[model samples]
Target: MHKRFLIIVIGLFLLFPLLGRAVDSNQQILQLRAQIEELQKKANEYRKIVATS
Candidate 1:
């Protein structure tokens, strides 16, 4: 029983860091997507100006 508990505790210690990285990666992806959308909007506006000229 003690050995089983020790293994579970060690497994969790290893798993938590991976979980934290996954959360960070998700946030980074969201930020990148937002930036891409903003840049696309600017490109479309520029296209409109060029088309008019």
Candidate 2:
């Protein structure tokens, strides 16, 4: 019974944070921006190739 209680308490401690919104890391934000830029460049290049052919 004591072990079960301890397990329940620990579960709540971890779950509490997930109940609130979280922050994104700077590295993650920068990576997303780079991905968007690369996709846009590829799209423009594809459009040019289609126009030529």
Candidate 3:
């Protein structure tokens, strides 16, 4: 019983970092998507200005 508990603890310890990294990566992806959207908006504005001029 003690050995099983030890294995479970070790498994969790290793798995926690992977789970944390997955969360971090998801946040990074969201930030990148937001930046891309902002850049696209700026590009559209520029296109409008050029079209007017």
Candidate 4:
């Protein structure tokens, strides 16, 4: 039982960083998507101006 517990602890310790990195990567993806949307809006506005001129 002690050995099983130790193995579980070691496995969790190794997995913790991967889980944290997954969360961090998700946040980065969200930020990048927001930036892309903002840039797309600016591009549409520019297109409208060009069309008007």
Top candidate (TM-score): 4
lDDT of 2: 0.87
lDDT of 3 by residue, 1-53 (tens): 99999999999999999999999999999999999999999999999999999
Least well predicted 10-residue stretch by lDDT in candidate 2: 18-27
Model 1: lDDT of residue 21? 100
TM-score of each: 0.87, 0.51, 0.85, 0.91
- Which portions of model 4 miss their true places by more than 4 Å? none
Flag regions of model 3 displaced more than 4 Å: none
Query: Model 4, residue 11: what's the lDDT?
Result: 100
Q: Cα miss at 52, model 2 (Å)?
A: 1.0
lDDT of 4 by residue, 1-53 (tens): 99999999999999999999999999999999999999999999999999999
CA lDDT of each prediction against the hidden true structure: 1.00, 0.87, 1.00, 1.00
Show the colliding residue pairs in model 3. none
Q: On TM-score, who's better, 1 or 4?
A: 4
After the best TM-score superposition of candidate 2, give how far the Cα of residue 24 lies from its true spot, in angstroms: 5.4
Q: Report the lDDT tens digits of candidate 2 across residue range 7-33.
A: 999999998776553444556788999
